[model samples]
Target: GAGVSQSPSNKVTEKGKDVELRCDPISGHTALYWYRQSLGQGLEFLIYFQGNSAPDKSGLPSDRFSAERTGGSVSTLTIQRTQQEDSAVYLCASSLAMVTDTQYFGPGTRLTVL
Candidate 1:
């Protein structure tokens, strides 16, 4: 079975640019999450999507951050205007629909804005 995956394991972009990070969750998993971890900082929840319910955007840092899940599977996170403060490791994880269930994470897309 294919595990979760993310693209551009590392990305370097200039401030104010837009970057699209991709995530592929594990097969059959219906719950997906997007999180950001600043350098030497803890994980910060960004968004969460489950099958059919409205997506939870409360955790999103700002209006520039947005994500969407398609067909209850793959998801993409778009940072409309990348900022220096946005430089961090963007991690995506998937779980088996149990809040207490441990989530499986991807290698992560490290974004570095200059």
Candidate 2:
């Protein structure tokens, strides 16, 4: 892809339902990341994957959140039993190498729980 593409730009669901957000990163990118942004909060790092290294999953808030990258390309984020507090925009970013340059972000998937 030319840029990071996030699916379901907007989603509305009842609390406790599982939701999966997809991200298609730019071609030839070696670093991929997931982030969260609440109503008024700054971007929060969720996870990062670079090359074949161990993924950095330190930012996931709870056990209900999980993500994975396949073939070092596309990635998916799955939230299980979503909560009201989980309502926010899920952003995915990619770079030729996050360790060296800046990241390019996607439009983001907006998830709303009621």
Candidate 3:
């Protein structure tokens, strides 16, 4: 019955530090996505996980970013060597099945790399 949720809603870290943002998707959802909303920018797709298949990571900006979905329910986005340019709101969404399906979003984790 719970909706998608992200932890440490606001994170402020120094440049070059590593940060891990967590997301818990709603139960029974088969598709999960990670998006980044930068200042004055649109939501940028980061990664997607559907069922047991390998994750789609083409949208990731660089090798500094990575993510994983455990048991098809929870996910974590890790940013290594955080940079000022990486500051943004990391949003997580889950859909019933396909990529075309409607997705429910979390409040997002606002990451500020100082």
Candidate 4:
């Protein structure tokens, strides 16, 4: 089956602009996650969605960042008022379950906010 995939492989936008990054997780997988890797920094957890349960958004960096998983499948991460610091590789991953499960990662969407 297909693995996790993110859209727009690369995005360039002016500061303060809004950008929407998409992710599609593998079928039958009930766990999805979003992460960001900034230059010279470790991967940062952004959010997680499991089945129909409430999403864990504690990892979101700021109110400017938000996401939603629909039909327990596709997900969209929306960043409002993008900032220069937001430039990074946004990664998506999926697993059969959480925590102990093995996660499959996407190629990631590279976002550049100028």
* Candidates ranked, most accurate by lDDT first: 4, 3, 2, 1
Q: List the residue pairs that clash in candidate 2.
A: none
Candidate 2 versus the native: TM-score?
Answer: 0.96
Candidate numbers sorted by TM-score from highest down = 4, 3, 2, 1
lDDT of 4 by residue, 1-114 (tens): 588889989999999999999999999999999999999999999999999999999999999999999898999999999999999999999999898999999999999998
- Which sections of candidate 2 miss by over 4 Å? none
For candidate 3, lDDT tens digit of each residue in 1-101? 58999997999999999999999988999899999999999999999999999999999999999999988889999999999999999999999997579
Residue 6 of model 4, lDDT score: 90
Error of 4 at 32 (Å): 0.3
TM-score per model over all chains? 0.96, 0.96, 0.97, 0.97
Q: Candidate 1's residue-wise lDDT over 1-114, tens digit each?
A: 478999979999999999999999989888999999998999999999987789999999899999988888889999988889999999999998849878999999999999
CA lDDT of each candidate?
0.92, 0.94, 0.95, 0.96
User: What residue runs in model 1 are displaced by over 4 Å at the alpha carbon?
Assistant: none
Most lDDT-accurate candidate: 4
In model 4, the runs with Cα more than 4 Å from the true position are none
Query: Candidate 2 — what's its lDDT?
Result: 0.94
Kindly provide the TM-score of model 4 when superposed on the true structure, using C-alpha atoms: 0.97
For model 4 the local lDDT of residue 86 reads 95
Residue pairs in steric clash, candidate 1?
A: none
